[model samples]
Target chain A: MVETKVSKSQTKSTSQLEKPPSLMRGLMLSKITSWVLFILLSVLAVVQLLPLVWLFFFSLKNNQEVFNLSPLAFPTEPKWENYVTVWTQGNINTYFFNSVWITAASVLLTVFVASFVTFAITRMKWKWNKLVLGLFMVAMMIPIHSTLIPLFSFYTTIGIMNHPLALIITYSAFNLPITIMILLGFYYTLPREVEEAAIMDGCSVHRLFFTIILPMTKPVLATTAIINMIYNWNEYVFVNTFISSDRFKTLTVGIQNFIGQYSTDWGAIGATLMISIIPILLAFFVLSNRIVEGITSGSVKG
Target chain B: MLYDFKKKGEHEMDKVMSDKKVILLYVLPALILIMTIVYVPIILTGYYGLLKWDGIGEKTFIGLDNYSKLLTDSMFWKSTYHSFLLAAFSVISLGAYLLVSVILSGKIKGSNLFRKIYLVPMLLSSVAIAQLWMKVYHPTNGVMNRFLLSIGVENPPLWLADTSIVLYAIFLPIIWQYAGFYILIYYAALKNIPESLVEAARIDGASPWQIAYKIKVPLIAGVIKVTIVLAVVGSLKYFDLIYIMTDGGPNGASEVMASYMYKQAFRMNDFGYGSAVGFFLLLIALTVTWLIRKLTATKEEVQY
Candidate 1:
């Protein structure tokens, strides 16, 4: 199935590059080599996923089973109670909700602001546009640890030290550079005629941007939003540093503390870790293409 | 008539788009956020390093003391060494990622599925990865030791407990977590190369290895340089996994600069000293980024 597609593309490319369809050599590997490479890739795929599979298995087993049986052995009877206990007894529910809301709010804030900024820099005429863009790009290189001390001090002075607002603002700010970077490529490729026609028809800048530009950029916006979602969802340092109370903490930090109490219980620990990661894994399964596209577009232009 | 109207439209378009008020409305929300959140705090970090306050105490200006102290601090230097070691490991691993990407980008079946599968580990949070790997490295019950013991090996080298092997042990998970990411990046770059270019080379009887080495590699040199910068700088700032897995532990054998700074500030409450370390980390990151870019700058851009 794949070989025919490969040869079809190769034939078209070769015929395009060469004037005559003279005798041509195969552009792909032979059957044996292809099989060898395919096997190697499959091995890597297993290596990448084996730990998670093992975790899921152990999560269903009691201590005796986890210890006595083969690592790959299925539980004789799955202990679904591990998941139930963590959800009901531990602070997993609070952390899960906090993670969801905070991740959503940050993604929304980041994408909205980044869209405007990218639109301004790429579409709207401004003299300091390049300089401002440079500032954001340079900020991408600044280590968050460098800002942690001052940010902590600033939050303290402002009396928001233990606030979830702290995490939201920092996530949005730290993420703007990358979000804008991804949007920059898409914005640049957009035709200027749309904005020109809207202005010619007496539309205000805000009107045109809100109605036309915003909707036009939905695809790239989805990419940046997913990228932001992954980042904000997985973020640990800010949540660990700022939010003190369990109610405000996200899954990343919450799971750390949750695991501390259940240290010796492999099944409970496995459940806790799985709970922390399931949201992201679910998103990846649904939107793997956009995530790949987002990451590639985000970094390649760097 | 049509030309004049079009010219007038252009003039009207410029007026609306270039309005300063509108520009600020568009740019300031994000600009202010970054400035106050990112830029301002960075400058303040440098200032905080000069104080002697214990996070919440009255500040006493102690100019250059913290900086000078950092210069001679053995722990600071040791942590910095560990950071560079991680950077070295990360950079070395890029070669492996590139090789996998080169093969995966070939005309292989289920390449898309393989790429996505490789990316699964990367999507999980570092804390999750850290916890999972800590279990995987458990001396008695970990999958690692179990496999070793089953194969007739008596001692499996307490992976994270022994100082000599802890750093390397932690690095294995780092490789696991990021292998998909770098491979995805390289694969994307390889796929971007014009199909016609590769076909032309193939017709000239270039072997696959020769084509990959001589053609594909040089063309993607720019992406390779970017990945190098990402890996090095990312490693320098690396804290989460190590912090979770070891907390730079078993007597600080695996301590890196970021975790060390984190401990000094948050754990030890020596905010001033942590600021000093933090500021130094910033300087090192920026300098390394610039250094890599300068070193890899070609006389002429790789123009395809």
Candidate 2:
């Protein structure tokens, strides 16, 4: 019986394969095989998204609903107020603003500094160019954990341990390697004739970099900026260590403490977590192509 | 037009491009920042390991004592063992990621959308991922236990609290968080393979599996080696999720090297010992990275 059933399906598939050669090529696999592959891919996608889906549902649910209902069940009435409560009750507002400004400041600082350095290395003829480029490249491999203890002491001695500047400067310094790596390729491929002409026409190096070269590199700048923004925004260790005051804490660490206060309040905890992730999600939706491009360009060539 | 003065202009261009002051002006700020922030502190970490000072106290140099203690400390060794375990798991999982990328890079429908969906987890903060997974493993009320109960099982293992299974429990989220990243990298590399090569193999009657195994994989061997280094080094330095999720807790069951170093310095105030662990971590990361590159060195890199 099993052999007959298999033979029947085989005959059906053979009939299906009688289509045109172009269609067969487009199919890439037999109909049965392609369906199986597609289904497997879909299953993987669902598994990847299930946790976030569950989180969104639980955020709308009260403890009673969460503890009683099936784990996958949807909330009958979405509790939008859970968001309002978490926003008003905790220091989440302060954390949100801190994340926004610190991420912005760090991204700006990193892009400008990286742009200047990349310009010098790629465009300027200088001794020690390869050594300097290698320095930045090697910095990417040094584990941040190794630098923590001494950095903690350095900030203490400099009296910036608790200051937001500590977080900003550290974010920019560590991020410089990847940002410059991304910019280096773009800078190298850029047409030097425009800048060469500008210089020959007595344009100062500063003017050439700012007005002509900088404007031309805007697309890559955006890529580096978004990449840096994501890293700075999601950063936890620096904020957790450097900034101890409540007012200065970013969302990453602030939400950790905030959730502790409401250990049993599933709705509130879920809402807080959602709020922390929403900005990144929004950025992803709008600029996903750029994010994908930046990540690939940053790592692939290495 | 500029070719008229190309000869004399070459000298002028050389002078402008190589100006000492301009180069210094452009490079100094970032150069100093990296030197002070990254380079100096790593050196200081090695130096601090030689002292026996609390963070706030005067230093008394006790050369090699902390390093010697690191050699004998069972807890330090345990954490180091756990870090190596995580690295092994990360390297092993790269195979699964590569397989998925091979399929996704094929002429599958909606591959772009599928790639983005997989990447959602990678974009979220580690704290959020940690916090969310905490709920998923909440023992009594989490999705895991709930599903287990519904299937007529009377008891489900305490995912994060049980020491034996806690490391594996933590590994699940790490896999979840990084799956899309590795998949994306491999997919990009696979996509970069010249289509003509795959077409030529097909014309010779090679199966898809045979094509992937023989032609595609060999061509992207350089990328695979780089990823191996990334996964190993990244796993060695893994901290944030484990720190936030477990805090190396429940009798230090899930302690890894980075978290252990953090606890020693920050929580326990043993700055000197923490610096030792931190320096050892740096050494291990650098040595393993170099070792992997040397081991995986091909006589001649495969080029198309």
Candidate 3:
């Protein structure tokens, strides 16, 4: 794609130039400049990934080695024991499972509910459609802090404070807007023929949505699911605010306390942090394009 | 070919699709959830601001006293100042991200991989980023100090522990976390420009700089304005990294508005004052969003 775009422009410019020597020199100079730009871009990429690489390195090192050896050095005998020790001994294992289940429940619930709303707003006619859509859109900008006090108080009053249900429900509610936004773009461009054809065959509304619409939207479902999964897995504020129990806390807050207790154990701290992030990293490695597409579509159009 | 059957088909579709019962079934769940979990609490924040109550105790009718006290609170003002300071720095830093995006949008090799690499930090949780960066800034064993000492520096400054420099120190990781997000947005926008327009400019002997500034920037003005609003409003609510890295520590040098409000309500149990601060944040976010959209509202957007 880049070659075509470049060569198309090069042909246009050469046709206009009519001077061979200067034109060839110009192409050479432009190629050199592009290589320079590419090199700088490569360096920027390195800068971005260096910290994580260093984290991985030191997660395998003891405090003595980390302090005495260079910051960038590989461990002489890599300590796979660090991960095993943290995972089995500390609260890290419990937090890891909690993050996984909570993240899964929230993402599934948020995406399904959001899909329902988007289908209604885009396909079904209602008097309050625009108003309801506007409400969700506006909610996206309401600072989460503004809602924190009321949410905290409400949870305590309802006796659900410190419950994983509280985390799941809050995650689902907050993520509804962006999920709908991404789904809305795809839903709007969907051809009505498939739905119309299904309706003509006298399919029930439930069946139509489940068998036809939902199945057809697998790509977007993956997108919203991945995005929500990332958000919920990494969520700290809500879990910290509501859940105080060590057994219930997600990795984010749980790891904070873990680090607090083992303050001087760099290997343990590093390993704990790695456990917290590995799920999201794995999700990105597999579904990166969908995540990128979801983010860009969710924001740029808005 | 035929309007009658098509019209009949459309009428059937709309009639079935808009069944009030099904529509209600579908939309009502999400609407109710957001209202109870989001909207109701949004209004309740301001109402709670009028009360003087701790999280566990009985409430007393303060009647705007908390709000009034917020107006006079020095710590509140300082936190607000720090938030706005971060906002200002974020808006300024868009220039650097824009530069990177402009280059990446060119015919550069591995641009796809580069952007993805840049986005790695963004994908991680704020807690993880904070923990990693805390290690990076550890006083004696941290990567920053070690590197400085390796380069023959006699002394390295304390990072998050130094009250004077903690806020600025916190900004470094914040910058690292967000650079890729802004770059991704700008790169996507830049890619939307028609290749023919750039080709025409090149054929006309326009330097790359002139083409970029005189033509490309004007074309993507709308996106830039959107990004400006995002950066400013986002920075205003920034919390996680600072909360983890410093916990507004070293005597409150890094207390942004969100963290300050969290500490007040959650830690100090000053629920009334915290409600007031939260309400103030909502107002500023809405106002800043409106102000930027109005200010950057262009009369005529450049067409493709």
On lDDT, the leading prediction is: 1
Candidate 2 lDDT by residue in tens digits, B1-304:
7676986677787899999999999999899989999999999999999999889999999999999999999999999999999999999999999988998988788999988888889999999999999999999999988889889889799999999999999999999998988888899999999988988887676767888999998898999998999899999999998999999977899999999999999999989999999999999999999999999998997778
User: Higher DockQ: candidate 1 or 2?
Assistant: 1
lDDT of 1 by residue, A186-206 (tens): 999989899888888899988
Query: Each model's number of backbone clashes?
Result: 0, 0, 0
Rank order (by lDDT, best first) = 1, 2, 3
DockQ of all models, two decimals each: 0.65, 0.60, 0.63
List where candidate 3 sits over 4 angstroms from the true fold: A1-22
- Which CAPRI category fits model 3? medium
TM-score of each: 0.95, 0.95, 0.95
Clashes of 1: 0
Tens-digit per-residue lDDT, A1-302, candidate 3:
67666765776676554222234456678778888888888888888999998999899999898888888999999998999999999978899999999999999999999999999999888899999999999898889999999999899889999999999999999999999999998899889889989888889888999998899899999999999998899899999999999989999999999999999899998899888888888988998899888888888878
Instruction: Give candidate 1 regions above 4 Å deviation.
Output: A1-29
- Model 3 TM: 0.95
List model 3 lDDT by residue over B1-304, tens digit each.
4898788888988899889999999998899889999999979999989998897898888899989888998988898999999999998899999889888887677888888888899999999999999989988888888889889997798999888999999998999999988898888889999988987887787888787889887888888998898899999999999899998888878998999899989999989889989999999999999999998898897799
Ordering by DockQ? 1, 3, 2
